[model samples]
Target: MNDSPGWASPGSAPSDEPDRGTEEQPTPAADADGPAAEQPSPPNWSKEQPPAGQWSSPGIPGQSGPAGGATRARAGSIPHQGGWYGQPAGGPPMWGAGWSPAPQAAKPGVIPLRPLGVGEILDGAASTMRAHWRTVLGISLIVAAVSQTLVTVVSGLWFQGTGRKAAPDGSSTPALRQAMRDMADTLAGSAVTSLIGLLATLVATGLLTMVTSRAVLGRSVTVAQAWQDARGQLLRLLGLLILYPLMIFAIAAAGLAPGIILMATGTPEAGLLLMVFGGLAATVVSVWLAVRYSLASPALMLEKQGVIASMRRSAKLVRGSWWRVLGIQLLSFVLVALVESIIQIPATLIAFVLDGQSLMDWANGTADSAGWTFLIAMGIGAVISSALTFPISAGVTALLYMDQRIRREALDLELARAAGLPGYGTDTTSAAAPGAPTDTSGDPTPGS
Candidate 1:
């Protein structure tokens, strides 16, 4: 084990076993293949330990140790056979033979997850959305417009033909009725539009991440620049698009089949039971998928990893954080739906008016069922909802990935280092020797 803390002062090395609270700077070394690599400068943190047996949390200031380390065992800066400042026992060793004590985490409510409320989720999402309002709304609108236009125009033509039929008198139906049904078909075909919207969203989502991260660091990038940063991962992004939907469909379909079978059984009680079971199954599946892919975009976008690599990395990062990821996702979806509802209301009302149905008439289904009018009305509503909802949905997912990193890795510091922020790790003046392996970088990770 390279006994030195990853960024500790050179002389601050553990005494025989380094003493806590001392730090020094290490000098760089020659590059292995070419020139020597330089050392990293002045240590960032001074290790602090309480009485050795009294599990000291080595985490940075302000963060608490997990539940007083009450759940399982000891909490300390002890280097376990499993790495990280943890108290891992007889399982596989993390990073390698060391325990990095975990810090207390922040949740979404009760200041963080204790007293959860739906409004907290809605308001948080709203705040996040507002922060990136330009990108969020712009991308969603673009998605809505492009997808809606294609589906509407194409279906209008397709249904126009499908609506045509010979009467018993061997005559075609009236052009107006055919036209109206064609429009309705186009409106119903919004699913196709939704798929294309997903692709547009892949782009929007990735770029939002780059831009938002920059914003977090008090920097900004033009949308075009953000797009460039996101461009390299397009293939991986598309791969995720394919894989994710298939997984969602397969699980949901599998869950739904059981419910359908139960419902088909004679007893309503059986049907209700099956529904409850099926819903639970689907919920589990969604949570599993969300956690699995929580880090995929970051892995792909920032690490320049491929689709499978990204997926594998994301899965690893979320190994112990499943429910938390699921909750965040659930909260995100619910918030998006609420936002869509607000947008849907006004559009629906306007459409109803345009279609010759008064709000009350339509609400009560008392208006004349003018086929063409109905098609146009519904079509308008779909178009509007798609435009407004698409971007924010995509943006929220990207934001979730960022939040995950922040919570798990203290990634803001890593990002700062990457950006060459003052006092950050990567600057040459403050650089660490690349080749002088303390062999400790992966210590926090277990047996990796």
Candidate 2:
């Protein structure tokens, strides 16, 4: 029931007659504790008007007026009363004698029902983990374990090489061919491992995005609920994941194509210069595209849109605020990187300790091979590290998408309704803050 500052109740002003110090000031006996002690009368705000140009508000006791003249009303302040406590004859005051600021929308989950700042977005992400640790961490653990195992197996099979020996044919050609074959095998194994990791990541992203959406509504969801919500559109999310990287690759190749042609035609020096500049240009464009469409996966999962539509949605949202979005995303990345390093460094050290010097020897080429123990320890470490990092990365992306929508589309009002906050949606007087736009056509919510 507290009124905002710069508003006053119907009364609480000095009396019409000049105030005599004797009545307004408390008698000395009023402070004494005895049968004869006099009690001071409380000021009757209902019958008084504050001093001219001063301010006070009902429900808020002891409000003081501005130092000089009347305070100017700020944007959201309620209008003041001019006379006695009786209600105005024409109608109710814009703010009744007893004015109160509107109640804030509740935040029972990750985010509040309002536009979010960067800190709030980060906090909401962390809160999702704290509130639903079992589901979030469990998903991450399984993905990490499976992906790490596959990576270890692939590395062992394809890249664990024996020492190179002199060519049997006594020519460098045989050695060169063998080295090239080994390189190709290594690249193939890497690609396979990467593909597996990408699939696991897509699944995790979809599931976590569902959880985050529910979390915004102060709702609890099980891993099963998350899976149910995400599975229908899982394929589309995966397609998005694949398509983005391919687009970047195509752009990069196009940029480098001219240089390659020039080099093939024996213009090596010019080709080198063109290659350097072109690669730089490609790198810049790639980053711009990446940041622009960074919200695509979340949009795809939440909006139930196709890969192309989600990408378009993200581009639209990011159109004018590209720099701000990029900065926030970059900050999230830096934070995630820091957390991953903190967790992985200790895990890697433990792996080294558990496996003695064999892992280091193999890494340094001082030994022909490493033992299974080294590989297993490293695999476990990788799993643990990935599990810890996965939720944070997923959470940041989801919340960032929500934040953008809140600013651009007034999605906060919709989220308030979805969260079942009272006095919102249809309650115009109290639905939104003063001056906030009123648009309540709901987005195609995630998990709907």
Candidate 3:
């Protein structure tokens, strides 16, 4: 049996050891006629020589002496063999045995959470769009547009412009426009306000949830895909969307229970006290619940969970992470507000200026505001603002939702598995619905 070190370490393990050591070791069969067999006296001790028992490199044997036990084969110790690793003649494999591994870069489409600077969020959104443009662009645009649309309609209904309300066209205002616009600030507008709020909430929740699911998967999908994925579960999502704020309202309203006891049988002061406590409790409850269940939309979109399931999932994912989400949300709100103020204020100021009213007259609410042109322009400005602001806001919420799951469940790893990326965990396709806007569970190929 031949037990050469080159055959041992870089090559192949030495063939099973000879049964007994004392017998003269048999030379390898193919090499019997080779030069080593023909050598009469000279033996090169330094190279191509290995100790008998299971050799591993311990130290390079000094030129003067035998290595203590094991030998450290020097650079030239083994002859280079090409066909072993099937390299072309005269060159090594691109990645050779001597190469050390490199540190891997972050997976594409990931949003890192280190303190991001101005435009970081936009950059993240743009990167996501660039990477999964086919997957993300249409859906993002659709969602963005729809979200903006809903917000625009709702805002138009809820907040009155300074002048007569015109039809969407810049045409003349309707006969009852002033009355309707005036009623916007009255109790009668409550119904219109609630309905608009509900619709807006539903659209935003479904879209943002989809964004979250795709983000976690490190995948991008389009509006059609998102809409399709969400179409079936939308009612449920809407219910959930309405439920959250409603629950908060209910809790806050509960504070009125004590005051109601006094008022129901007796005095106005009891009712007043109930209103005060109820209002305060509602404020605190609403804020906390909004933050707590922020993740619920994605949970539903990805997990097909019920309202409770989604809420619980969100609550669990956000248990200790509320403040971070809150801060991110607040930041987004400020951006939205800043951008909106910048755009709308000028339009408003222009309207006030052109209305032929003095500054004092306008401030005193006695200004005869500009006609339908001003209102139409204001509507256009509002729509444009909503279009730009809402999409990014939706994107951030979705991104944040995905990030939470990634941190808690190693969802990114699971997503990698789904995307056929190396080093991922179990594939999660089954967790998503059939016909859902996900393409992660397929094999990946190069050079199609």
Candidate 4:
């Protein structure tokens, strides 16, 4: 388990028994060696060479020497090629060779309390869902049902029928007129749905971020508890949600407005060129800003920051890793889109088949469609799809925020401690604690 402690267990302590002698005495050799060559000067103890049965270097042997009974191997020596590591051929073994280093602890939570890999981030999100399915799925199901119900109601109210006017030439043109009306209504409905969806998303993000914080510590959170922790930050998060898109819209509009005016005044060629070029430029800026402020909501909810402050915090966190963050976010979005399409496409096809109208005729608003049946069926499918999608999207966003903090702030250590792992102090605070002061002694702020 990744969360398992790296330290050895207590039972691994070495014994303190003293060493014993096991030397074999040299025989007299029947006085044939002529007094053993004058007893050869006693070997020096201070020389570089080790005594017999001792190691010189990793693989080299030292000169032999006489000793009590038998020679003592040098202390704390590495084992020879095939030797057992039981009692070294010398004194008592030093402490701590009794056990191998303890296997690293399991991560014990949605993620290992360390810098996360891309797969780990995705896995963490899935892990959170699996661990707290009731809370996570409940939040998503409620939000999805409400959002999809609103869409169904809105579509029923505004999308069923249309009024048409005669052409300027006094010819009937119901198809063209109906198409125009459909387009207008669809755009209007999309705008309203987007607003409602954004509101739901803000609330969901707040609740899930709280859940994720607890999940990081391997603790499950209830929906009510999540709401309690999250409610205070929702307003600021919602403000951020509103303000961020407005900033993008404002940039795009500012870029395109001049070109629009020129085209309206009849400089079609120049206006077209400017519109295309300006749009491209605005797109580049918008994507950069999107990635830059991506962490703002999590920063606000987790750090208890104000709207503008959260934006600043996000900017601080994102400073050096823009491309990486952007890639990961884009990948997450693609996966979300894929999941939605997989589930919703079949539902939509089922709705279409059950509606019993020719595709062309229905699209042209010429068929007597089963309006409520179509709307309700589609709504149900949408609800199911959204329910499955919401948790993943929320989890990914929250984990990405944490991953960034881990990289920038060494947050994994704090998380490990918070998770009650060994080697980490039990009283240490969370690295993402709201408004926590950084240790400015030598620490580099994100900007630095």
The lDDT for every candidate, in the order shown, is: 0.55, 0.73, 0.57, 0.73
**What TM-score does each of the candidates earn?**
0.55, 0.73, 0.58, 0.72
lDDT of 4 by residue, 278-332 (tens): 9999999999999999988888887777999888888987887889889989988
Best by TM-score: 2
* Per-residue alpha-carbon lDDT of candidate 3 for residues 129-243, written as tens digits (9 for 90 to 100): 4565554545444544554455445545555454432344554766477457566665454566456656765775576456545654466566665676667778888888778
Q: Itemize residue pairs with steric clashes in candidate 3.
A: 135-221, 135-222, 138-223, 139-222, 139-223
Q: Estimate, for each residue in 1-448, the C-alpha lDDT of model 2 and write its tens digit.
A: 3111224454344557673334666456543555656566887677666444333455455555457433432223433322333333344334444445544546857887656788988889889989998998888888788888888887776656544333457676777778787668767877998998899899889888888887887777788878877888999988899998899999999889999899989999999899888899999999999999999988888777798988999998788778988988898889878877787777667766775765556566565444466677778877876777777788888988887787666667666755555545544334434343221233225322
Model 1, position 120: C-alpha lDDT score: 45
**Candidate 1, after superposition: displacement of residue 213 in Å?**
2.7
lDDT of 4: 0.73
Indicate the residue-level lDDT of 85 in model 4: 49
Q: Give the TM-score of candidate 1.
A: 0.55
lDDT of 3 at 359: 65
> What global local distance difference test value does model 1 have?
0.55
Residue 343 local lDDT, model 4: 84
Model 3: residue 61 alpha-carbon error in angstroms: 20
